[model samples]
Target: MARRRRKSRGRKLILAVAALCLAAVYPLQEQLTDGGGDSRGAGNAAAEDVSAAASDVFRDGSTLEVHFLDVGQGDATLIRCGEAAMLIDAGNNSWGDDVRDYLEYQSIGDLDYVIGTHPDADHIGGLDVVMEAFDCGTVIMPDYEKDTQTYTDVTDVMEEKGYELTLPQVGMVYELGEAAFTIVAPNGEYGDNANDYSVGILLEHGENRFLLTGDAEEDSEADMLDNGIDLSADVLKAAHHGSRTANTEAFLERVNPEYVVISCGEGNSYGHPHAEVLNRLREMGIKVFRTDEEGTVVATSDGAGITFNVPPSESWQAGEPKG
Candidate 1:
């Protein structure tokens, strides 16, 4: 909810402390979780030294954090910039409480923007609980509708909370603390395919940009490319959990991301991050991270640079369908 005037463009960093994208990002949650920075005074030199070090690294007092949470074959991403926090999706219904746990763990302040990329249960199933748990700013979702209880539950909560479902329009930009994000997808309608109607967003924080297109397939991807909007990003959240149907080579070429984060279960039925997609990413020399293996992966960007909490996986592996 912390808004700021858009800074003039053109201060993009060369790469993150991150080819594995080059941003000065780190896993600051562990420290924040462990009660970072003792406020009881500098009586403890060690504590003061540690706090000073953290202060030096996070010099600007604001950082853009994107956590690709592991919600078992579902998608949930938490993006935070200083006091402003935004959530893309919150995974399945069963994971709703866990999603709250995820938010609570970070001590995330206010959620300015809470988006349900599409009405798929995996994406919005947990939203009802999340909305009930936190106070959010603008809540956006695609105009697409579904005839399911999961969807109904979300709407019920929204109605009760006096929250309105704001539909996204292409080119609309919003702010979160120091970072800014633009609505990029749902360019047009696609009949009954909710995936194509997925509301995608491109987040920009300093030199780092991340593109997250929830479950968008080839048709939607093509539309995004033709929209004349820049699709290039430092980090790409592979659509449809890296399903071959989405993440086409042509689409990947346009985005040309340095790092790719694929969120799926350990042994999901869909076999996400399929061999074909993984192969293409590997060929392109882009580093890869997976929620299935890495649990909740966090990427912290200090404006000029972006870095991931965990290193890219060394294994050339694709998710296997559960037996």
Candidate 2:
């Protein structure tokens, strides 16, 4: 009876161990069968793998960093090429703190270029605050002026800081670190409209190019075309807050950017990022990233290829629309 009980106990122990092994292997087999093992857990694992790839595209050093701050219905772009930095528009007055905080977060101690783009309240409202907060090298604005207090405030700060404002001329080039940029708009003449006088910049780092049109409308774009400037770029900052008033098809065709960025507030009163502009981009199969939807969008380039802060979704990777 003692021998029989010992054998039975050993059999039970072996069965229990086998069951545990099966339990472990079954879940793994089920996972493998589920659409090439792309279960939620597997997907998370894949995401981790991709994250670890660490292209080092945006890290400190020779890499170039461009930040599109979420200023809400306005524009603020910060570009950092190694130790050199440039700020393009600081958004409205209300965004002053946010813009400053962002610059500080990026460890920016001084600014090589502070651009106002235009004198519109939405464009220069925070210029005074930025100028007051940081040591700026040069301030760039259009030749046009506005009669509002917003304009006066920026000038006062510039005067207080003993900074001279330079009117960007067409074909003028600015070299910062390893990057270089050309002023492509406010091209020699001004129109009665403020939007037409907006300054446009084409920044080049290695082979990568970025075009930022600060509310520039079709007239200015036409001037760029007439001047026979190279308009092809990797990215285009859609003008006039993506209003139909700008981003003409001809301009888009000439630029042929792979990606387009539109900056505006969510549910803005102006109904910005008009459908027409989005339609044009979609028709051209260009990828669109919006401030309202994506929050602050940052693009980093190593002078070879560009990378974005957000990764493409799994569905987008698999050639399916994201729900």
Candidate 3:
């Protein structure tokens, strides 16, 4: 009888251990499926590795579409090229779901790059939520050292998600098929103001080039010009949401973009798209679009020129030029 009792106790102990192990694994498996698992094993087997993800998405010969997402009071831009996608600066934290929904609506299942132009909350705030929701390939940002809580939270989530952080540098190129993106600003030392440290990128496809300037001020813009980087583009994102401090006349002349997109919120405190900046763009005869008025702006290219589409308009007839 004593021997039998001891045997039964040992069996019970083994069963309990097995139960605990199974419980642990169940949660891990669940986490992986719900965007909480090891970043290495969640995506298509081909995207299992970060480097592989970049190479697969950027393989030569891809079409590109640039979407200027409407994240009110902040900035969020999405670039889609073939099977790959990249996001630049998620708006304020409140717009995370909007960003995710927009991605889902467009059938984007994987993200190749997520760039936080700077540490400002309006720029990097929504990134944490995005990191938690997607299996990101890699994250790139300016080399800014700030002590803000938002910055800390963004870094913590990136580290936790096992994302490789890359610092933007001029001459560095990111390729996706036939499309090529070159970093244009934040060329040297990190700046004193976070905005000055904004990461500027230029995307080129055939004769078409698009310049994205992330709230960079006069100082940074001047530095980019002094460095002799090609500032010309067919499309330009107006710096600092069209603030007077940016879009300097000389810088605008160098870019000479045919179209300019400004991202700003309605009734914003800073009075973005200042009168002076608007006049400058008007004087240059550049077509200007604003998120505050147009909702979202999308630019698509087919290896040659680009086309613009606005939300359906009843007042205007088909083929009619937009005001």
| Leading candidate by lDDT | 1
By TM-score, the best candidate is: 1
Across residues 1-323, which tens digit of lDDT does each residue of candidate 3 receive?
11101111111211111111112222222433453211112223222243334334433345577777767668989887777788998787666655665565455687888889998888787777777777898688988868887788778878887888898878789875567799898866644788889999998977899999898988889888987778799999989888888999999999999888888876677778787888888888877767666556666677776665442111111111223
lDDT of 3: 0.70
Quote the positional error of residue 135 for candidate 1 in Å: 0.8
lDDT tens digits, residue span 86-188, model 1: 9999888877776775576455556799999999999998888888888888999999989999999889888988898899999999988899999999899
10 residues in a row with least lDDT, candidate 3: 1-10
* TM-score, cand. 1 vs. native: 0.83
Candidate 3 TM-score over all chains jointly: 0.76
| lDDT of candidate 2 at residue 158, scale 0 to 100 | 86
- On a 0 to 100 scale, what is the lDDT of residue 33 in model 1? 49
**Model 1 residue 192 CA deviation in Å:** 0.7
State residue 225's C-alpha deviation in candidate 1, in Å. 0.4
Q: Score candidate 1 by lDDT.
A: 0.79
Clashes of each: 12, 1, 6
